[model samples]
Target: MLKFNHLFNTLVLLFPIFTYASFNVGFKQINLDKVGSRPLNIAVWYPAKNSGETIAISDNTVFYGSRVIPNGKPLLSNNKYPLIVFSHGYGGSWRNLSWLAYELTGQGYIVVAPNHPGTTILNRDIKQSVQLWQRPRDLSRTIDAISIDEDLASYIDMNKISAIGYSLGGWTVIALAGGRFNTALFKQDCMTHSNLKACELVSDLGLDNPELNNSMKDPRIKAFITLDSGLARGFTPQSLKNMDIPSLVIGAGIDVGDMAVELESGYLQQFLTKSLSTYIVIPDAMHFSFMQVCKVGAVDLLNKESEGEGIICQDGGTRERTEIHRELSYLITGFLSKIFLNTAD
Candidate 1:
């Protein structure tokens, strides 16, 4: 616990919020059935009149893997924060994404995130695996939970809320922003693969279940961001072409020989209806840009397998990846400040 305290103090000094109070709620029990309706043991990091309580900050693999940064942790909290909801990739924990969460919170946004059931730390548990299919519904529900639940209703300004997600979390944000997140599309993408990794990593997600996809209805979210979130299950110009809301898409391009991804952010900038949409491509990034240290450290974990397939991944350093994360933070904060904070929609 002292470790977290030291980590927290180091972070507090670096990110003194000049805007709003920052409070963090961590490692709370999550109700898989709840989304917008629940207070997800989240950390609200803004400029607050330091409450008398000294809660412990956790040490996860996020900041250079069990290697704490000096007087740092990007996921640290700040002051006078705006509200932001951060969704993590599949098969991770709330702590796994703490780096991004703390970063946003410290920068003055109330960041809320939930452990998508089957996609959590206990991922191998078969019964929990079912939660993967419940993602969109879960994202929507989490929004509802905070919006309607009396506990956090007074704290969050719904109009100021924005969402940042990566990978599957990327897909989930799209659905919340009114894009089609379907299972059939996932299946279609998986047809050529004949392996378990294909099923577990790509297809089995409930993102495709129509009953779930068609049921999502959220208006509180002001903007959407997808990192490495590929094509939506149902992407038609009609559906997203004229989405006037500010949309940012970040993706990657891979070199078949180098195992390096040419990072790119691809939103149809020309589609006037999707007027505010912007895209960027990160050079040499892989599919795991937006994850905790485990994924980043183990990046070679998959790359090792790539060698057998005649592919050699040029493992860029953590410094490079950290730079990418910084870029992400800057982009998101800037976008939200412009659209949700500085300018009125």
Candidate 2:
């Protein structure tokens, strides 16, 4: 018994207990009529002063929701927190990145994610989804609304703002960073790569319109990160070369169907000549791995609802989705700390 206790004590000493800061998540809807866009449903996560009733966010039969305090009082602090605006993949809602938002808030940062109308799961409008330009505008407008928000504005440091996106959202942040889209180039590529999922939707996506070429850059975002972005071929090399900001480009090493890292994420990093960008490929991850974690019987239920929908829960290698998320958290938090907190390992 004495020896066993000594061994247990040694093990405990080796792996010290870690504590996380308390945080709360709040939801709001902001109108974008002035910008000629639809209203946005947003989720804001930040440090909290007191714990409230803990509830599961985005809980459903398929995906497991994140547990967080809702509508709790904000933490009182003199120091301003860095702001991170997150954009989800096509057809995803703010709930898609709820886990990451919670992680960031616990680390003393403010995180906000907006459900882009038409493209979000809650509201899918074919007309709005085709207007890809409006996607980036959604994020820009989100920042505008938050900057003046009574509850959160005072706690955020405007100058320390950053953007993080997944899938199509990745393309959105790149556009915000001054990457211009070339509709003609995209159409030409689609014609040859019709097998690609993005190309398969070219007809419906309307890539030939000249309006897509317009710059949608938002200067407020100082740093950005992309996770397995799509439509990267639409951005011209010259435009990517002109993106002068700190960027972290992450890609899923495993290709699931039409999305390929070399053609999308790698392509972005290859042409980003002017930005101080870091590139990383998560070997065991797939395109859908970046989404919310799935429940035990999620795959069966998803496929039962719609054939092939179960792929959303699939990953490349043997590692579980939770394990992938841990690596992602480490990489992302380390990058943010290096840029904002000046505490890079």
Candidate 3:
């Protein structure tokens, strides 16, 4: 029994516990009306002081992830923190990336994530999907709202803003970072690589309208981080070459095997000739693994609820979800700090 106890103690020592300051989370729901009557629903998360309550979250009755209760006041910290605008994947809700939001806020960042109205699961308008140009507009609008809003402006450092996106959101950030969309190129690639699932989806959505194009780049965004970017083939080499911002591309290793990583995230890193680009591949991650950690029995429920989309319920083999979040938080926070906060090793 003593020998067993010794072994347990040694293991515990090897896996040292990591902890952070218990800062209360302050949350607010803002309506960005600058973009006309159809105000964008912006979910803001920031550091606060006080207790919070647990609340339920959902995506148009499809999948239900974990609930979060933010505890704190509306007051901003004395220090001016960098702002991170997060764009969610297609048919994904703002709450989908709440886990990452929570982590960033806890580490001294004001994180604002908005749900792209028509593209979110709550709406899912195919016409909205086709007009992919609107995606980046949604993000710019969110940034504008935060800037003018008296409450949000005080907490954020306007000059040190960065953007992070996943899946379709990844494409949005790339566009915001100066990568222009090319529908003709996308079509040609699809014709050549018809077997790619992303191509098949694009063909179904028919996002080939040239009239919807616009200048999506925002000068305020100094850095961009993308994860498992989708439909990246739409950006031509010339458009990407124009990008001068520091960008990071993270992809799921499993996505490479699935044939989804090559066209978007992979393509961006390979073709961005002028930008400072860094790429990292999480060896065992899948496209959906970047979302919130699944709730109890979420896999079974998702399989029973939706077809083909149940892959969202799965994660990399033998890897705990919390561990993935921890690693991501560490890398992301470190990267942002180095560039925006001017904190160097």
Best by lDDT: 2
Encode model 2's per-residue lDDT on 1-345: one tens digit a residue: 011134433443344222234445543334445365576777888887666677778788888887776766778766787889999988888888888887888877888888887788877787887788888888888899889988778888888889999998998999988899998888888787666677766655566668789999999888999988998888999888877888988899889979988888878877886338877777779999998899999999989999999999999999999998877776777677667754221
Global Cα RMSD, each model:
9.3, 7.2, 6.9
What would the per-residue lDDT of candidate 1 be over residues 153-224, giving only the tens digit for each residue?
555666676777776677677667766445664476446432313244443454344564463536767788
Q: How big is the positional error of residue 345 in model 1, measured in Å on the Cα after superposition?
A: 9.1
Ranking by lDDT: 2, 3, 1
What is the C-alpha RMSD, rounded to one decimal, of candidate 2?
7.2
For this target, which candidate reaches the highest TM-score against the unseen true structure?
2
- List, residue by residue over 237-334, the lDDT tens digit for candidate 3: 88887788778777776753445665556788777753377666776677887887776776767778776556786876679776766666666766
Worst 10 residues of 3 by lDDT: 1-10
After superposing candidate 2 on the true structure, give the runs of residues whose Cα lies further than 4 Å from its correct spot.
1-37, 342-345
lDDT (Cα atoms) of all candidates against the true structure: 0.51, 0.80, 0.73
- Answer with 1 or 2, whichever has the higher TM-score: 2
Clashes of each: 54, 0, 3
